[model samples]
Target: MTAPHHDLRQLQRQAGELDVRLAAARHTATSADQLVTAVVTGQGKLVDLRIDDRALYGANAQKLGLGIVEAVRNARNAARASSLPELNALFGLQPPPPVAGTAPPLPPAPLSPPPQARESVQRQAEPDDESFEEFDFLTDEEPESGGGRW
Candidate 1:
């Protein structure tokens, strides 16, 4: 009767339907060469693997292994890609409501410093003699440079 109770019941029904769909979800893929085939569930469990007899006939073992992996990956990717659109539709989701009106008033214009404060900041930024000193490492008092070697 109330809005919250109705929403909860609708959500529970949708969840039950989604659970049923997920339990039924499956994807199958075969390698490009049709040598390997794989079937996976929405939960990404490998339900079946099939290898053609011709695939095993003098096929490189490593290549066959790679083909099987590729098939499984393709199946999982297909399952994910197909399920996403269905779930989105079931939930009635859309692209974020297009930013209502005048772009949220532009964050209150960033509070600039007054001219006097800016001048003070500029004066402080200028280097003073007390902040730095030049040092000469080659001043004529070093023993090795004065031609005295131990």
Candidate 2:
């Protein structure tokens, strides 16, 4: 019983130390084209952002937005990588191998479906000639007398 209590106390102490370390941690990353940079905390909260004047010279909103997102994502990954060892130790897991870079390359964006597939979807969505009939708006019938006109 005492042994278990001692172990619990030790774990609590280690967790406290980890919390302090995380609070003091900062990680930085830059966009591939050197256009943007971001700094984040160990908890992956953005602390700073920097953009090169060149990036804004002729850039559209979408291009600048993507650069900012990339930098922040990389910075967060770096912070997570840096904290992995301490986190593993706290949980009694084996130390992870050294990280070579901020993080693995992000997976490629999904590609749009082929033109043939798109055409097929459009064909399916079209109304069949038998399914809908045209309505004539030129009918000569008079309006019903129930409601008065404005």
Candidate 3:
């Protein structure tokens, strides 16, 4: 019916608008000490980075690196937080309720294979003793015959 067609058209239009918004979205964040600043897109791709000259003074690579990482992480978190509402709307999901006095949950640690499985894999990957036959080509004996002339 006409209603279904209208709904599809509306959805297409909303998608186009969301695409434009996402493309134009940019979030900026600075490190706690204000030594590093980072700008990221809606998808958390770093677009710009700025570091204070003081941050590099005395060649403190570790401090500078940490500042850069913090700024970039903050920028990415900002981008995600800003875009989450629209994403939830598009997906028809309710925003999770905030818990007081609780920090955001950390991502789960990566799973590793059990020791038995790892040992099995290692055993399977090992080459057998009989798999290769040694060939000795350094014998002092000369050829028995020269069948063809040069």
Candidate 4:
């Protein structure tokens, strides 16, 4: 077989390095007013959260709540983004803005084995002798005593 390309090996190495970085770090993000801070870790853990008391002021309570939600999601996005170089290199793509909802692609399933040969191989693998015993209901009938429960 021909030797694999050097570029492929380099990409693999870059991906490995990126994976290591991703495993050890986290990301933090806050809303526009700095009222909330959200932290997310490499293994998808939400490590810490902080919200300013002023965030709940008067008419802005709803906006503050929305900001908090946005902060948390953005924090996770940042973490995923931090690891994107590795992911892109690994997948041989330019890269994408990683997000919390995005799941890594799963490997494709292998092709099915040929049906006729598969059946033949299965038949050969099975034992030649087969069991066909059946139980009879009266095989162990006991002599009844009319005096007691039957």
lDDT of 2 at 123: 76
lDDT of 2 at 146: 29
lDDT of each: 0.63, 0.69, 0.67, 0.62
Error of 4 at 97 (Å): 14
Candidate 1 lDDT, tens digit per residue, 5-99?
Answer: 99888978987876677657777887767799999886568999999887765533336766787788777777666555555555777432232
lDDT per residue, candidate 3, 1-150, as tens digits? 899999889878987887787667788888878989999887789999998888866544446766888788887877777767676666668653353213232232223468898777767765632221122123343334422211
Cα RMSD (angstroms) for every candidate in the order listed:
21.6, 12.8, 15.3, 20.4
lDDT tens digits, residues 1-150, model 4?
235677678767876776676767777777667888888876446888898988777545546666777777777767665665546646767655455334452232223468897777667765643322222223354334222112
The TM-score between candidate 2 and the true structure equals 0.61
Worst 10 residues of 1 by lDDT: 100-109
Q: For residues 42-121, could you state the per-residue lDDT of candidate 2 as single tens digits?
A: 77889999998887654333367778887888888777777776788678897544652334534323234688987787
| Candidate 1: residue pairs that collide | none
Instruction: Give me the overall lDDT of model 1.
Output: 0.63
Please provide TM-scores, in order, for all candidate models, with all chains considered together: 0.52, 0.61, 0.54, 0.46
Error of 3 at 125 (Å): 27
Q: Is 1 or 2 the stronger prediction by lDDT?
A: 2
- Measured with C-alpha atoms, the lDDT of residue 4 in candidate 3 is 90
Q: For this target, which candidate reaches the highest TM-score against the unseen true structure? A: 2
